[model samples]
Target: MQRQLIQPYLLVLGIALTLSSCFNEPNYPDTPSADFKGIFKYTIAAGTGVGAAKRDSVVLTIGFKDGDGNLGNDIPVPKADSARYAQNGGWGNYQIRTFRLINKQYVELVQDVNKVLFFPDLTKGKPKGAIEGTIDFRQIFTYGSSFKMYPTKFQIKIRDRSLNESNVVETDTISVPFPN
Candidate 1:
């Protein structure tokens, strides 16, 4: 009798687990939702190194924001909007995935068609977009940082610099009237 009850419970648990996993995340496609459009900005909180040369940030003017709000233009990294080391030399690298309004949760800023840095990783969490992380300088002329970006209101959280320390940003909601 006990074995019969145990088997049923085990079966139920297995099924529940499978179903829960599926429903936990919203279904999202690579393409943006139809009618979705906007020019959302992702601002990063700059980092600094102890002994590296300092430089100015280029103040990148992001170009295209698609229907689903995926960014498809080169963020003009002018000579100005780069890292400024405190001393001789260090590098900083940053990758920003430009957008999903609801599903994938961001407007991806993709300059290259061959690579993806964030949100696409559905294996980790729900596809609601993210701001990956941050980096001061992995080497000279390179600032290594990535984060999962979220739409609705610009918020910078979960900073990951150099595969080490991180600080996630806090945020509140901003209502955007749905488009007709």
Candidate 2:
């Protein structure tokens, strides 16, 4: 009887140890800092419409450093000047609030109808229901190009949610270099 109890305890302890060790971070990234060079500019573009007409540019630039904790000037991202969303559900019920990058893989462009504060919902107040309009996701990645230049590409995705009227616009990407 004691042997049976011991086996179960050992098994549990083994699992706990394994789980803890799984959290150990690995020092490997698909797009390592070494893979890039010189000034890298990440920009948030306004695809179309009044948002495009009223484009508020935000850019980030990385100086001459191979990831040794060095960030340089902020350069504007390439402007698409071709992205526009037509009003589908309401009458001029859209307001571009914020443009943010979520994690290392998501760039979100928000358009809230009700002008809801995304902080309370996205950060602290995660609503379970829906949100208004749609969010576009953009990713910037290097195509393993030349040594002097790592040409980047931007990928875009349109995602729509349901809610009364919340203005939260974000355009994010995972391919962009993360700030240390």
What is the per-residue lDDT of model 2 for residues 11-95, given as tens digits with 9 covering 90 to 100?
A: 9999999999887433332211211112234554535544342222223221111111111111231122112112333322122
What are the lDDT figures for the candidates, one per model?
0.30, 0.29
Question: In model 1, which range of ten residues has the least summed lDDT?
Answer: 133-142
Task: Give candidate 2's whole-model lDDT.
Answer: 0.29
Worst window of 10 by summed lDDT in candidate 2: 65-74
Model 2: lDDT of residue 17: 97
Using TM-score, give the best candidate's number: 2
Off by over 4 Å in 1: 3-24, 32-52, 56-180
Task: Report the C-alpha lDDT of model 1 over 50-162, residue by residue, as the tens digit.
Answer: 53433222221221111222212223323432233111123222233223356746543333521322222112333334222211211111123332323443222111121
TM-score of 2: 0.21
